[model samples]
Target: MIWNENIECASRDSMSQLQTERLIRTVKRVYHDVPYYRKKMQEVGLVPEDIRTLDDLVKLPFTTKTDLRDNYPFGTFAVPMSEIVRIHASSGTTGRPTVVGYTRNDIAMWAENVTRSLCMAGVTKNDLVQVAYGYGLFTGGLGLHYGTENLGASVIPISGGNTQKQIQLLQDFGSTVICCTPSYVLHIAEVLEEMKIDASSLKLRVGIFGAEPWSENMRRDIEKKLKIKAIDIYGLSEVMGPGVSCECTHQAGMHINEDHFIPEIINPETLLPVEPGEVGELVFSTITKEGIPLLRYRTRDLTRLIYDKCECGRTLVRMEKCKGRSDDMLIIRGVNVFPSQIESVLLEMSETEPHYLIFVEREGNLDTVKVQVEVQEQFFSDEIKELQNLTKKIKYKLESTLGISVTVQLVEPKTIERSAGKAKRVIDNRKI
Candidate 1:
């Protein structure tokens, strides 16, 4: 069932050699054609030849989101505009969107990588995949669309939104595989319950979820609700869409396509490489991309890497599920909190649903956090004493886990807003 066995199962030494060769050519290409990279290399008094080995990757300057913003549009692209067959950009909530370009070869390579990822998830030509990620400027929908076709699987490019229609299609089409954000899949589960359709009525066997940091508890919830094997897939628009890495049937860690993209974990503050299996910021170098090759691009995602061979028989390095982004980490009352941590605690409890929101507010020069959680229909009783006990239990659990006292308010089912895309987990109103 392994796709592209030559690349995915290459020996460590063979892979390293392949990466070195690709890195050398990528560096030389960017050094000459891209002014941004050329200037970066010149400022460090380094040349393309200095990056002859994989270890020499440390010599190259790191590219950040700010660098992409300063460059704008196509400034970071190595090839001319005519050569770029496709363009994609981030949502750019902070400022100008980080733009990425792709040549024909880049597109082909992306399809190949995603095909490998689909195969890893146990998707085959006989499966029908329903792509629920957004299309157009966003990469998720189209990325999975072509990958499913490339894998010889029938694809339904349903895109996002239209919940009722999504459920109808899932039932009518007998989709065997689904690709979308984890949150949206949960939303689908809620809709399925509302429609009074048993999950076994359809033929869904596999769910590929990504585009957000979700917890293992959330995975279990998804599996229970949808009755499908939930697999995690990781990627970014800056590096490549949804195919950068994916979990196999083992579900241990996501196997990175190291033959095409080189991954490094570095301390966010010190900017030094961390020891293997240590939590740090994840960085990437696009060694095989042609239109816009990046050197040591800082991804800001916090995770650790595993180099041991996976039980799935793939030798590619694997990364633990991302805990959270460095920038997304919230500091409240001198304590660091990740929304995923809160999510894990909430999902572990049977009285509450996966839907919740974290609100941080400033009151009287002090920062306070209030968590709004959704209570299951059976748990939403009007008995005041019962409600009080449930709230106290949740508050105690959150305080024990987060080391900070938080107000827990239990709302009725479906009170929190549901997301059709990436879930909005945190709302910080503190004016700091």
Candidate 2:
């Protein structure tokens, strides 16, 4: 069912007016309060007064992850420390982390967005949601946690990992909904299989999966293995976490909460807006955020937006499932490849399991890619000739799809390591 019918189903004329109003206020505030933003605005030769309409948003300088990293600490926050009630930083693997602070109102807005997302996935106040996303500095766990509470649903804040305990609670609590990265949910499914327990035994009816780009084939696998509707949710730590947009039960596309944050798509290479329905980098401008209101924040995610009204009766614009990230695209030798492309090919084959990883390395001035794929137990046999043929078959499929030859190593089921978070899809060892 639809949540916040007034806003979600609002007409384009009305939504644009609301966005323009918030954008004007946010731009004015950031220009006046945040020095970094003020300087960026100066560099663009535009002032807050120039941003009178949503069309003027193009005048604002784009914010990048580098900008956040360079600032570190509390450099980009618009509000004073006295007003900042909570702080969340990115779990960066290198360099200083991108820090984000939130006011009480910001937290409430976040909760409202997440609650709306849960409702989009058909979650009711009576549903028990088991949030398996990790907690702490990561936004996934607490983001979902606060939203579930706001929705008045019973939430089991059982964080990630602990396979045994996760299954134990699922059986005992009979939670109707689960939330976590798509890959982690697959890992849980594997554990359930090892324990000789069937998914039908649980009460889980829906799963909200995000944090990593997954294939449509993989969604089918999740649905079959978990016996639940695998709904795709979209968000990032920089944008506002997993509740930014979510797929309704119709499963057409994720509906963006345009009232709180406005969405835009731009050509990554040219840094210009792409035509409607054309894939490009996704950008967000947080108009309602007070603690750290970002103007024209580039998210680097590559996806197209849909404007047609959905069968679910929501007029909120929809974003197609992410094709891949412009930043995440791996350029091996001359051809660019995405992990999801390989995943789609593997999942479509019955003999191969869903678990796999890609290793990119440089040797003697040449780039090499090796794919480690898990073969189903029935397909993993000692017959060298049969295994060789199977490997060749998979290699041909991948080569045809990716337009690049890759070394395919077929291993027994459960050989590839399973992760409790976003699956480590690629390991690039090139010293570029």
Clashes of each: 0, 0
Q: Can you write out model 2's per-residue Cα lDDT over 73-146, one digit (the tens) per residue?
A: 88988888999988887633222457899899989999999999999999999999999988877788999999
Residue 395 in candidate 2 has what lDDT? 93
Give the Cα lDDT of each candidate: 0.87, 0.85
Q: After superposition, how far is residue 24 of candidate 1 from its true place, in Å?
A: 0.5
Alpha carbon lDDT of residue 76, candidate 2? 89
Candidate 1 structure quality by residue, lDDT tens digits, 1-432: 899999899999999999999999999999999999999999999999898789999888999877887888889989889999999986432324568999999999999999999999999999999999888777888899989999999999999878888898899999999998776788789879888999988899999988766778879988998899999998988898898999999999999999989999999999999988899999999999998898899988999999999998899999999886776657554334668778777778874458889998866434689999888866667798998998999899888877668999988777788889978989988543
* Candidate 1 residue 241 C-alpha distance from true site, Å: 1.1
The candidate that achieves the highest lDDT relative to the unseen native structure: 1
